[model samples]
Each structure stands twice: as C-alpha cells, then as structure tokens.
Target: MTYATPPRRTLTALTMTTLLAGGLLLGQTAAAPDASAAGGKKVVCEVDKMRQQSHSLRARAARLQRLGATAEARKARAQADALDRRVRACVDADGNAPKPWN
Candidate 1:
C-alpha cells in the first residue's frame, strides 16, 4: 500500500478556497441569479458575473452588427448592460455604508 500524508490546516484552507470558487461559478451559472447572497461576499461574485455577461453581450452585439441583427442584439445588450450597472452601483453603495450588514 502507498503511504498517504494526513491532511493539515493548510489543506483545509485550500479546500475552503476551492469550494468558494466553485460556489461562485455555480451561482453565476443560473439565469435568474441568486440575489439572496447579496449581503455578503456573494455580492462580489454577482458583480463578477454581471461584468462577464455584460462584456460577452457587448461583444456579441458588436458581431451582430456585422450580421445585420442589430435590433435584437441591441435589446439584449441593453438588458445585460443594465444588470452590470446595477451590480456596479451595489458595489459602490455597499462600500459607502457606515452600518452593519445584518
């Protein structure tokens, strides 16, 4: 049998980080979004998702212009951009507050 090393505290920390990253990815995979986590670090995660989606939507809208699908592309891009802006506003407002996050 091969000798295996026992887990240490550092391994626990690494596991926590991996789990957190996975949760963020899963949270962003939903179409409706889990805004329930908005009070914590998950807000940051949502901001990242919104930013990524906005960038992708913008790029797709630009490509659509070349394909002459401007109207639909622009509409969808507007929605994505609105979500991105809201996410940014949440980030800015959260950091500006002077109260607890209960």
Candidate 2:
C-alpha cells in the first residue's frame, strides 16, 4: 500500500496558519514593553488623581457633618470610599506604588 500525500490546498492552509500565528506572537512581544510603560504611567497618574479627589471628598463630608447635613455627609463619604477603592484597584493593576502628588 502507498501512503497518500496531503493535497496542495491542505499544505498551503497549514503553512499560512503557522505563519500567521508566528507573526502574531512576534508582534505582541515587540509591542509589549512600550504598551506596558504607557499604561503604567497612565494608571499611576489616575490613581494619584483619584487619591486627591478622595481626600477632598472626605473633607467635604466632615464639613457637612459639622453643619448637621447628615445625609449630604453620608453621600460624600460614600463617594470618597468609592474613589479610594478605585485608586486601590488602579494601583494593583499598575503593579507598583503611585508617585506622591506634588
């Protein structure tokens, strides 16, 4: 019995698939460092801004509490908490500590 060779179309398809996969991997590796650096910087800046906003919100909440606007104070506090959580998530995603605000 003789073994049958693969059709030309089948061989062409396999070769194209291999080349496409290799090109994708190479493109990703080449782009990774620049993308990460830009992304990291953006995350750090965002986290810092969120931290500042959170602090302002907390102060506003305290002032509202002093003036007997308990409902407003609570709302402000909740906003501050959400901002804090957002900052934490950004820091975690960035994989580094954010720079101190100047």
Worst 10 residues of 1 by lDDT: 36-45
Score candidate 1 by lDDT.
Answer: 0.79
Tens digits of per-residue lDDT, candidate 2, 17-93, equal 99999999999998766645555664344777788899999999999999999999999999999988877777676
For all predicted structures, in order, the TM-scores are: 0.48, 0.50
**Full-model lDDT for every candidate:** 0.79, 0.85
- Pairs in clash, predicted candidate 1: none
Tens digits of lDDT, candidate 1, 1-85: 9644566767878899999999998877875555576454544437777888888888888888789998978887897879888
Q: Please give the RMSD of candidate 2 to the true structure.
A: 8.5
Roughly what TM-score does model 2 have, to 2 decimal places?
Answer: 0.50
How many steric clashes does model 1 contain?
A: 0
Quick one: best lDDT, which candidate? Answer: 2
